[model samples]
Target chain A: MQRILNVFVKYRNSILYLFLLGFSLIFLKANSNFHQLKLEKISLFFSSSLYSFSNSINRYFRLEKENQRLLKENEVLKSIQIRSNTLFLYTEGCNNKTNFPFDVQRVNIIKNSFQSQYNYIIIDKGAASGIKREMGVISAKGIIGLVQAVTDNYASVISILNQDMKINVRFKNRTTFGSLIWKGKNPKKFSIEDVVSTSSIKKGDTIVTGGMSSYFPYGIPLGVVTNLENNIQNGYYKIDAELFENPAELYKAYVIENSDFKEINSLMQNIKQ
Target chain B: MNSQILKMMGSFVLLILAQVLLFNQINIFGSVNPMLYLLFLVMYPFDQNQTFYIFIGFLLGFFIDFISQTGGAHTIASLSVSYLRPIIMKYSYGLTSERPKSILTDPRKTNNFVFLLIFISVHHLIYFSIAYFSADAFLLIIKNSLLTMIFSLILILLISSLYRVK
Candidate 1:
C-alpha cells in the first residue's frame, strides 16, 4: 500500500498529463469521435454569448464609422428601391417572403478572419433569426461566405477566404464558369481552378455567382480577374481574381436562405440515389 | 501565497480577455494574428504543482478555443505545451532548469529567449496542424507556423516582460 501510494505521487504529473491530453484529443471535433452536436451546442452557448457581448461593446465605440457605412449603404438601397419601383411586378413578389427565392436577414458580423486558410466568421444572427446551415451570406459589395453552423443568437460562416470553400462562379456577361478556391497566402485573391484555358479570358473580366446551384441569386458581383496561369500540358490553369469586397472590411452581412434550397437539395439527392 | 494565487488568477482572466479581444482582431500583413493567449502558459510559474499547471493550461486553451470557435485546436496545443514546458525548460536552461522561475524573472536572458522560441514555435506548429488537418497542406502548415510564431514571439516577449520579477 505504501509503495503504491509512493508510486502514485511520483508519477502523478505524467498520469495527469496523459489523462488531460487524452480527454482533449477525444473531444477534438476536427478528428475525434466526441459527442459532436452536444459539444458544439455547449461551445456555441458559451462562445456566442461571449462574442455577442464583446461585439456590442465594440459596436458602441464604432458607431460613427458604422453610421457612415450605413449611410452609404442606405443611399445605394434608396437608388435600388427607386429603380425597382418601375417594376411593380418584381417588387411585389420580392416583398412577399414566400415568393422570394431567398430570405435575407441582416446581421452584424461580430468576428471576421482572413489570415488563416481555414478562417471562419461569426455573426450576431442565428437559428432564431431564421439563418440555417448551407445558407449563403453576402455583403452589399459582394459575396461573403456560406453559413456552416448556427445557434440561437449566433452563426459561424465558412468565409470565402477558406481554402476548403469552393464557390461556383461564372465570368460576368459570359456563360463559361468555374469554382473559385482560395489559394492561401493572400486574402484579396482567389484562384479559379477548373477554368479551362481555352476560354478567351481577359485581364479584368468580371466574375459573379453562377446561380445554377441556387445557393446564391443570379448575377451577384464577386471579383475581377487579375492574372492567369496558362499551361498547355494540363489544359487546366489557374485564374487569379481580386475580390470586390475586402475580407477585412466586412461589417454587416445578409444571410440568404434559399426558398428552393430544400427542393433543389432533395432533387440532387434523389438523382444521386 | 494566497495573494500570489489571486494575482495569477487575475492575469489569467486579463490575458485571455486581451487575447480574444485585442490580439485576435489585429491581422498583421493579412496573415499573422498573434496567439497572445499562449503568453499565460509561457509566464506561468512552475513553482506551483505541475499537475495543477497542466489543468490550468487545459482550461485556458479550452476557454480560448470556445470563444474563437476553432473547436479543440487551441485546447490541444495549449495542453501539449503545458506538459512539455518543463522538459523544454530543462533543455533551454540546462543546469539552471531547477530554478524555472529565473527564466521568467529575467526576460532578457539568453536562455529565456531560447525557451520562448522553442516553446511558441511548438505551440504554433501544433495549432496550425490541427487547423489545417490535411497532409496535403504540409507546406502551408510550415508557412503559417513560422509567420505566426514571429508575431507571437514579439508580443509574448514584450508583454510578459511587464510582469517580469524584479
Candidate 2:
C-alpha cells in the first residue's frame, strides 16, 4: 500500500492528464450517439429564448421589406397552387402524380449562408414545431436542405451548398438524373454526376428533386443546367447546375414533415434484409 | 482567490452570453464565425490553479457546445487549451515570482498576447473541425477552420487590447 501510494503521488499529473483526456475522448464518442437529455433540453430552451429575441429584433428592423417580399411571394405561390390544383384535377386517375406526402411549416430564416462549401442555415422552427431530424426544408423558389439539428423553437439546416451534401437531382424535362455536389468554389453552382452518356442533356434545362430521397418530395425545383461534360474513363455525364434559390437570402422556408416517414423508414430498414 | 474566482465566473457568463447572443449570429462573410466565447479561456489568469482553470474552461466550452448542439467538440478543445495554457505562459510569458497576475499586465505583453491568440485560434479551429468531421470533405474543414481562425484572432486581439486589465 505504501509503495502504491508513492507511485501514484509521483505520477499524479500524468495520471490526471491521461484520465481527463480519456474522459474527454469518451464524452465525444458518446455524444456522437446520444445527447444528454437535461443538457439538450436546457440548451433548446436557451437557444429558443435567444432566437425569439433576435427574431423580434429582425422583424422590427425589416418589417416593411419583409412584408413586401412576402406579399409578392404569396401572390406567386397562390397562382402556382392554383395551377398545380388544376393539373392534379386533370391527372386525377393517372396515379403518376402523387401529391407530396408531408406537412410543410412556414419558417423564418434567422441566419443563413451560401458562399461557403460547408454552409448551414438557422431557421425559426424546431422540434417544438413538429420538426425532427431528416425532414425536408424548402422555399418557394427551390429545395433548401434537410434538418440537421433541432432545438425547441429553432433548428440548424445543413444547406445543399455544403460539400458533404449530395442529393438526387434530375432534369425536369429530359428525365436525366444524377447526384448533385457542391464544388465549394461557387455558391450558385453545383455539379451533378452519374448521368449516363445516353442522356439527352442540354443547358437551360430545369433540375428538380428526383424523389429518390425519403425526406424531400418529388418535383421540387433544384436548379438549371449550366454546363455538361463527359467522363472519358467512365463515359458518364457530369452536369453543372445553378441553383435557383440563393441560400444566403432565404427568408421564409418550409419544414416538411412526412406523415408516413416512420412507416416508410421502417419498411426501408426491412428491405435491407 | 475569492476575487479571482468571481472574475472567472464573470468572464464565463459574459463569454457565453456574447457567444450565444452576438457572435453566433455574426457570420460576416458566410465563412467566418468569431467564437468570442473562447476569449474566456484565452484570458484566464495564467497563474490560476491549473485544475480549477481546466474545470472552468471545460464548463465554458460545454455550455457553448450544448447551445450549438455540436456534441462535445468545444469542451474537448477548450480542455486541451486550458491544459496546455500553463506551459505556454511559462515559456512565452515567464512566470515571475511576483504574484502571477502582475506579470500578465506588463506593457511588453505582445509575446504573451500572441501566444494566447494562437492558442485561442487553435481551439476554435479544432472545435470546428471536430464538429464537422467528414473524411470526404477535408477541404471544407480546412477552409472553414482557416476562416474561423482568421476571425477569431482578429476578434481576440481587439478584445485583449481593449480590456483594461489593471
Candidate 3:
C-alpha cells in the first residue's frame, strides 16, 4: 500500500492531466452526440445580454450608417408594397395563409463566426420568444439560415455560408429542385448540386424554398441562380446560387415560427419509428 | 508573487477578449486569424510551477475552444506550446537559476524576439494543422498558418513593448 501511494504521488500531476483531458473529451463527444441537455437556453440568456450591450454601443457608434441602410431598405419596401398592391386586388373574405405561414420574429445577429469550419451564428431570441430548433431564419433581403439549437433567451442559426448547410431550393415555377450549399470559397456564392437535368433553370432565375420545409413557407426567396451544370455522378443539374443576404453583413434576422411544426415533426418521428 | 499572479491573470483576460472580439472576426483572407491569445501561455513568468503553467494553458485553450466551438484545437495547441516552452526558453535565454517566468530582457535583442517568433510559429503550425486535419485545403492551411504567425508576432511584440514589468 505504501509503495502504491509513493507511485501515485510521484505521477499525481500527469494523472490529473490525463483525468481532466479525458473528462473534457468525453464531455465534448457526448455533447456532439446530441444526447446532452442543450445549454442553448443559457447561451441565449448570456448572448441576449451581450447583444443588448453591444447593440446600444453599436447603435451609438454607427448611427449614420444605420440611418443610411434604413433609408435604402425603407425605400425598397415602399416600392415592393406599391407593386404588390397594384398587382393583386384582395377579394372579399379571401385569406392567403399559404403565402406566409411562419410568424417572423426579428432577432439581431449578436455574434457571427463564419470564417471557421464549424461556424455558428448567435442571435437574440430564445424559448421565451418561441424560437425552437429546426425553424428557418430569413432576412428582409432573403433566406439567411435555419435554427440549429435554441435556448431560452438566445439561439444559434446555422448560417447559409456554412459548408455543411444543405437547404431544399428549386427554381421559381419549376418542379425540379436541388440542394444549395456553400463552396467555402466565397460567402456570396453557393453551389447547388444534384439539380435534375430536365429542369430548364437559367442564369438570373429566382429560386425559392420548394414547399418541402416545414419551417419555411413555399416560395420564400433563396437567390438568383448564377450557374448551372450537370454533375458527372448523379447526373443532376448543379447550380451555383448567389444568396440574397450577405451573411457577413447580417445584423437583423427573422426567426420563423411555424404553428404546424410540432405536428409535422411528431408525424415524421412516428413514421421513422 | 501575488501581484505577479494578478497581473498574469489580468493579461490573460485581455488577451482572450482581444482575440475573440476583434482579432477572430478580422479575416485577412479566408484562413488567417490573429492568435494573440497564445501570448498568455507564451510569456508566463519562469518561476511558476510547470504543472500550474500547463493548467493555465489548458484553461486558456479550453475557454477559447468553448467560445469558438472548434473542439479541442486550442487545448491541444496550447499544451504543445506550453510543453515546448521550457526547451525554447533554454535555447534562447540559457538555463537560468530563476524560475521559468519572463524577465525584463533588453528590447535591443532582436535575436531573442526572433527565437520567440519561431517558437510561436511552430506552436501555431501544430495547432492549425491538428484543427484542420480532415480538410483537403492544404494551401489554405499554409496560408492561414503564415498569416496567423505574422499577426501573432506583431501583436505580441506590440504588447511586450507597451507592457512595463516593475
Q: Write the candidate numbers in order of decreasing TM-score.
A: 1, 2, 3
In terms of lDDT, which candidate is stronger, 1 or 3?
Answer: 1
- The DockQ of each candidate is 0.24, 0.13, 0.07
Give the Cα error of residue A21 in candidate 3, in Å: 91
Which regions of candidate 2 deviate over 4 angstroms?
A1-99, B1-166
How high is the TM-score of chain A in each model?
Answer: 0.66, 0.66, 0.64
Kindly list the interface RMSD, in angstroms, of each predicted candidate in the order they appear.
Answer: 4.7, 5.0, 4.8
Instruction: Kindly indicate the candidate among 2 and 3 with the higher DockQ.
Output: 2
Specify the CAPRI tier of model 3.
incorrect
Query: Tens-digit lDDT track for model 2 on A48-119?
Result: 999999999998999989887876676556334423533533455322334435555678889888766688
Q: C-alpha displacement of A112 in model 1, angstroms?
A: 82
TM-score of chain A of 2: 0.66
Candidate 2 chain A lDDT trough over 10 residues, lowest sum: A88-97
**TM-score versus the correct structure, for each prediction:** 0.43, 0.43, 0.41
lDDT of 1 by residue, B58-78 (tens): 999988877766668888899
Q: Residues A1-273, candidate 3, lDDT per residue (tens digit)? A: 999999888876576567656655554544343312233544677999999999999889999898768756754563343224223232322135433335656678999877875568999988898888888887776677889898899999888878888788767767777788888867778888777676677888987776576766566676888877766677677777897877778887766677678888899999999
| Candidate 3 chain B weakest ten by summed lDDT | B97-106
When candidate 2 is compared with the true two-chain complex, its DockQ is: 0.13
Number of the candidate with higher lDDT, 1 or 2: 1
